[model samples]
Target chain A: MDVSFLFGQFLGGLTTAMFLFLIASGLSLVFGVMRVLNFAHGSFYMIGAYLAWQAMQWLEPTLHRFWLAALVAALGVALLGAVIERVLLRHLYGREELYQLLFTYALVLILGDAAKAIWGTQQLSVSRPPLLAGGLDILGTTLPTYNLFIMLIGPAIAVAAWLLLTRSNAGRLVRAAALDREMLGALGANVGAIYTGMFVVSSFLAGLAGALVTPIQSIVPGMDVEIIVEAFIVVVIGGLGSFWGTFWGSVIYGQVLSFGILVFPSFSIFSVFALMAVILIVRPWGLFGRPIR
Target chain B: MSRCRILAAACLAACLAPFAAGAESTIKIGFPMPLSGPAAVYGAPVTKGAEMAVQEINAHGGVLGHKLELLERDSKASADEAVRLARELIIKDNVDFLVGTLTSAEAPAVSTIAKENRIVFIAPTSKSVQLTSPKNLHPYLFRLASNTDIEGHSAASIIAGWKEVKRVAIIAPDYAYGRDAVAAFIGYLKKARPDIQIVDQQWPKLGQSDFTPFITAQMGTHPDAIFCDVYGGDFVTFAKQAGPLGYFKAVNNRLVDGGEVGTTDEAQALGADYPYGIWSDAYDPVIWAGDEPPEHKAFIEHLKAFTHEKYGSGWAIMGYSAIVALTDAIKKANSTDSDKVSKSLLGLTFDTPVGKRTFNAKTHETEMGEFWGQMVKGEHYPFAIISNPKYLAVGPFTD
Candidate 1:
């Protein structure tokens, strides 16, 4: 009830919001440009965590090993995304929306099984680097240094992504493609290549989020499904395909969950869905999303 | 004409070979468990334990001259899937007995199937009381693991001994298992220590990756101790996230966890991040410094060889005990008939690696207790081991 306690809760919510933003942003981008709802995005995130853990095992124990492992995981997932897009997804883009949705759903099952086969169903964990292993006491509440790092990185990624999508030539082409693929294609732009590129970038973000979350969460089977549901909710609440909408949506969700626990401890699970339903009824296209043509 | 008659005889022998082989003396037990996914952390080890038990039993001239064979199938930790597998194992595979299922949700459903088929089913590790409650209890269904009430009471008794502790908070996965355990703990704790204040309770859904808000919210309550029931990977995550935030230190490191987080697997998984000094329980412990029983020592040796792991898991003992109990029942009844075996299983006294366990005839539940102790660093292993471990018998509480 006190100001300090409220402030602490807010900070905690912010940390969760940042984590959600990382995963949802990629989902939003993929939907925005390619109109393909990638259900395997969470699988990519899970693989990222697993890869990071494996990489950490192979790498020498050092202060910078955590960051290096995370980079490797993100890149690995991005490469995987590229191959999936090229080999399987490219064929389905021309088909009905149902086919695309089913394809991604199939990927979810396959990737989930694949992860289990590779990881052998044991729960794995990655330790935080020594530099980020401590805590920072703020307003009489101790917050994890790793959580603080995530908070900072989330916004930084948002800014970087915004600059890329709005300021750069590649960004302009991607935006144009999202608006009108046929028009962009008529303008002699490589539409297929742009779609692939967007998918890779989205996958990279998801992978990065997964690798970063390893220090806090135990990497286990079914984590892919757990995270995908939340990420999907975030995207849906923010209006699918709206990058900034995802950012704000995550913020709203994180706070609702954090404070909702305080107010209604037993009903916190329903709070997220209730908020989503309200948002849909009030603003069907999402807060920042435009109406579909 | 003579050559054709000889060929016809040979063909008839080949066609009848399968039925003749099917009648060969072997007792088939259906083992349905989560072999893949997150639940496999417990399921895989449990299956290994059952396999070890089956091997040991078969080596000793079999159970009443019938070699025991396990028909293992992946239940995938879903109740529907477990029910489906149970039917298939009963109808198609024609298994004589059933012994598997790792979760509360799956066990009760499978119990119904066992009831309908009139096959003896021994639940290895599902701790929900609903599995063997009065309304649901049947002649064929039996539970090996201690129910939620026993587990909760065990935690309560442990906390009651801490004279300085007053304000207590609870955090558990928001479901029947968690709710039941917490309710039992509070009900017992209030009777034992009336002065103790129940400060706050947080019900995080199972598989929730984030524990920050819950952690911070509980910390705000300023409780002297926390009773946590989060288990497996979720517990690992909770500890990792809570450690850096000084949540353990703030409560003076007095958290009593009742989900078998004291097991070697959990300790090793969490490693240094494992919250030391937290009171927890495990069904079996591989390391028993001065009080190691010969049977336990031998079992650990076999388990190490079987699983190719340095330390035997506490979870494995549940599966090992179930098989041992089934084989013992079969020996007592001197028959593979479900009715006979189920009758024999009642008031059945069996030897486990930990010690002797008995199934109460009235409840159809095993009097299985766990080794409760505070976790602390030991010189022998990298992870924390139970310090001053005490095996709390469920008899006193259950009766």
Candidate 2:
């Protein structure tokens, strides 16, 4: 009930918001351009964390090597996404949405099992970077330095994403593809290449988010299911294709969860569903999403 | 040797092969445990231990002129699956005995089927109090592993002895095992320290990934010690999330936990994130080393080699012990009849990898307790080590 406690809770919520935004933005981007509902997005995130840890271990495992390994691991997932887009998703684009959904869901099961086979069920933890290992005093409460880094990364990526969408020529093509892919194809645009690029970029974002949180989270099998469920909620709450929508949605959700735990400890999980239900009732397509054709 | 006669003779030989194999006589055990789920980390090692024990026993010329055969099935850590497999193992395989269930949820279902069919059931690692309690107790059901009551008391005894501890908090999974573990710990804790005040309690749903809310809530109450019963993947998540919030380092507020938290596997996995100086109970190799029987040392070595240095947790020991006890009961009865073996299992004493264990006649629960110690990184262990180890006896209430 004190000011400092409230401030601390708000910061904790911000940390959650940052990670949610980092993950949900990628999912929203994919849905916007490709019209494919990727249920296996969480698998990419999980693999990013595992591969990052593996990469760091293979390297010196020093604090200096961690950030570089994380970047490379995320790139690895991006490369994988590109291959998947070329080999599998390209063929499925002409099919019904339900079939696409089923395919992605199948991928979820296959990827989850593959991860278990590779990593085993034992939980793996990544050590905090030595520089950000401890806490810093903010007012009367202490906050972890690593948490602050994650919070900053969220908005920094948001700005970078905004610029990429608004300023870049590829961004214009992406917006056009979201509106009408047939017209863009008729206009002599390589629609296939654009879709692949979008998928790769989105997967990279997801992988980056996963790698960023690895230092604080214990990477384990089945984590993909846990995260993907939450990511779906975030994307749904935000408009599916809206960038700023995801940012706001994550922030709102994070605050609600943080405060809900304090006010209603048992019902905190229900709070998220309640908010989503209300949004669905009022704006079925989400706050910023366009009506489905 | 006409072609027609040779073909007929081949057919006859093939038909009689099954009968001859049946005549040879083999003791079969239906081993159902979580082999392909989140619980497999614990269950797989147990399966390995049971396999090794059976192999060793069979190599020494079997149990009473019958080769030991294990019919292993994946229970998937579900009660429904366990019950289904129990029926299949019995009706389909026609096994002589049932053993090896991982979780408490699977324990009762398997035991019920075992009782109804008059088959002997031995649970290697299910530790919920309800499994062995009189309410669910059946004549054919026996447990070789220590239950929650013993573990809780062992944890409480250690916590009570901590000189600076005055207030306590509790956190566990929101299920049967978690609730019972906390209750048992609190009951013994209150008895030990009558003046101790319980400040807070948190029961996060099992498999909860985010512990920030729970951590913040627990920190608000400001207890001197927190007793946690969360294990497996959830434990790792809690440790990672809570460590940053200074949950482990808050002055005079130590953390006490039951089962598998500070073991070598966890310590190696967590690396620098492992909470040093926290008190926990583990079935650890370091605890087994130094001064123990030669057989215990040999069992440890064998398990390490067999697992290829992958698993050597207490679950392995439990699995190894279950087979030892079952074989011992059969040896004592000197027969393969389920009813006779079940009767012999009552008040049966047997040598295990850990030590000599006896099943109490009334409860059908073993005298297995827990090994309690403080987590430390020392020269003796490459990973997390239990520096000071002590074994507590399973009291009357454990069953």
Instruction: Find the candidate with the highest DockQ and give its number.
Output: 1
lDDT of 1 by residue, B1-399 (tens): 999999999999999997887887689999999998889999999999999999999999788887899989999999999999999999998999999999999999999999999999999999887888889999999999988888888899888889999999999999889988898899888888899999999998899878888888888888999899999999999999889988899888899999999988888888888889898988886677558889999999999999898887878888898999999999999999999999999999999987899999999988577889999986789888888778875422431
**What pairs collide in candidate 1?**
none
Fnat for each model: 0.69, 0.38
Deviation (Å) of B224 in candidate 2: 1.0
Q: Positional deviation of A72 in candidate 2, in angstroms?
A: 2.0
Residue-pair clashes per prediction, in order, are: 0, 1
| lDDT, candidate 1, A238-265, per-residue tens | 8889889899989988999999999898
In Å, residue A220's CA in model 2 sits off its true spot by: 1.9
How far does residue B258 in candidate 1 sit from its true spot (Å)? 0.3
Error of 1 at B179 (Å): 0.7
How much does candidate 1 score in TM-score? 0.96
Weakest lDDT window of 10 consecutive positions for candidate 1 chain B: B390-399
